[model samples]
Target: MKLIRGLQNLQRAGIDSASGCVLTIGNFDGVHRGHQALLTRAVELAERYGVPATVLSFEPTPREYFSGERAPARVSNLCTKLLDLGSFGIGQVVLHRFGSAFAQLEATVFVRDVLASQLGVRAIVIGDDFRFGARRAGDLEMLRREGARLGFEVDGIASVCAEGLRCSSTALRDALAVPDLTHCEALLGRPYRLVGRVRGGLRLGRTLGMPTANVNLRRQPALRLGVYAVEARALNSDGTGGEFLPGVANLGVRPTLGLTRCLLETHLIDHSEDLYGRLLEVRFRQFLRPEQRFDDLSALSAQMQRDKSDAAAFFASKSTGPA
Candidate 1:
């Protein structure tokens, strides 16, 4: 699983050795089941054509560029996307920057330069309604025309659905709006996850005998403010086996404590170790309850105990202990 951060970094390697590949292109925000179908088509095409399976996605995601603002709540971050793509047997990924220069490229320039010249794409796969390039004017027909001119082939995948509704990132985001992990999993093909660096917090959890590692969101989304039942993975300080921690997390401003900045505080059940300045990936398995403002520290402490008990029951049912 090679991670090519930028086009400049990729081109600096002299030449891309991958002569032929079955490639799919998209924003792939959540890499939802619909995106999976396209990737699956790419894999199948690669197997049949004896070429590497490749994915071409954009950084800063096109939406961020078009929106002229920070991205909305991301379903998966860069690290998580790389891992998820690797799990599907994708060998190569080209992450192009979606800056003004690239975004302004015409539909044909993108096809000729990125698809034909760099990737040496033997075949291209995309969703039926896929579009790209300057103001997102490129469509399936445009790709087909470019494929003919560039001597590559194009395949369009139809929508993938579950329980009647089409599986889509928008649908997944809506499901997450209500903190519905079960439905999110069905749409995402995995748990919805957030990746962040563990940073220092107020240590209020420490005072309550439930020390927590804080994960700060780089780009905050409108996630339902609440206490959540989560399955978290903490990286070992020595970089050995990653530890999985069943825990409860509070995602909100600590109203009772009168903190203004939003925080993610997770108290691991039966685990204690310093995680300051480490990277942690937290995967939300389910929503437990909404955050509440207690009248006093003692009231807050009492609620924390109940949250732990609920977390314990949730983990016990799964039969997987802390990793």
Candidate 2:
């Protein structure tokens, strides 16, 4: 998908920024069912107008900037979020860097300079609770006022819900915290997944006889630190290609190894190819066990063996517990 990084990038693109376009704006953190619904509307409008549907979002999302380490754990990183958007068939994306300077831009300037003049947005789709600009001044009312003079349309969508709960990034995070991914999968219409590039690690898993491919979790994580029954996929393209490989994984800091930061270490069952520098996706099928410190490497390695056995039994039986 095409990306317009910021205002300057959009201005320099040489294409008519004011050309007919339908747009949507938000963190879209998880790209959950709710976000998908809004994006679908924008795409439909774009198709009706013979224009492109563009997603306007921010990096270092507002919550991450304001709350620092206190921000909610991200449900999906940039790589995953972009992939999900692409699956919805968005034409392009605009990632605005969020910082102190960008934060203070006046509401009118944001509407006029960014949404109106720059994007030439023919229509915009967003949630009813949406707010934007300095000190949270922009809202549905602001969008309507600007649309009146800007020759564009504005739409505010209601939230989507499942099991009496609104589908939201926060709700997904809460579910992952419980490690109850069954409910998460229902709300998301798919498994809760973490995708990232595999990086070189200490090779400690090899020593334990369960070699792993290490990847970054991409935020101050909200998911519990534990072993999980999972499925891994090796992408053959820019994360769109799918090749599933069953696996078991541990997402946590190795307290026994004295590592302070959490990492995801996954061991693919029945396959071992060099994964360093490649992107892979892991889907949480179910929670297995909590992480704990062992008396020695031998003890930890033994526990890992049990985890492998448990995962094998799960897949072999093809049994999914109480619905």
lDDT of 2 at 253: 84
Give stretches of model 2 more than 4 Å off: 14-16, 319-323
lDDT of 1: 0.79
Mind giving the per-residue lDDT tens digits that candidate 1 earns over 64-172?
Answer: 7778664566666676667667667787787878788998999889888877877778999999999887878999999999899889889999999976779987887
Displacement of the residue 12 alpha carbon in candidate 1, Å: 2.3
Per-residue C-alpha lDDT of model 2 across residues 4-59, encoded as one tens digit per residue: 78756876654355475799999888788999999899999999989889898888
Off by over 4 Å in 1: 14-20, 47-51, 69-71, 235-244, 256-262, 273-279, 294-296, 316-323
Clashing pairs in 1: 244-323
Q: For model 2, state the Cα shift of residue 219 in Å.
A: 2.1
TM-score of 2: 0.94
What is the alpha-carbon lDDT of model 2 when measured against the actual structure?
0.84
lDDT scores of the candidates, listed in order: 0.79, 0.84
In Å, residue 203's CA in model 1 sits off its true spot by 2.9
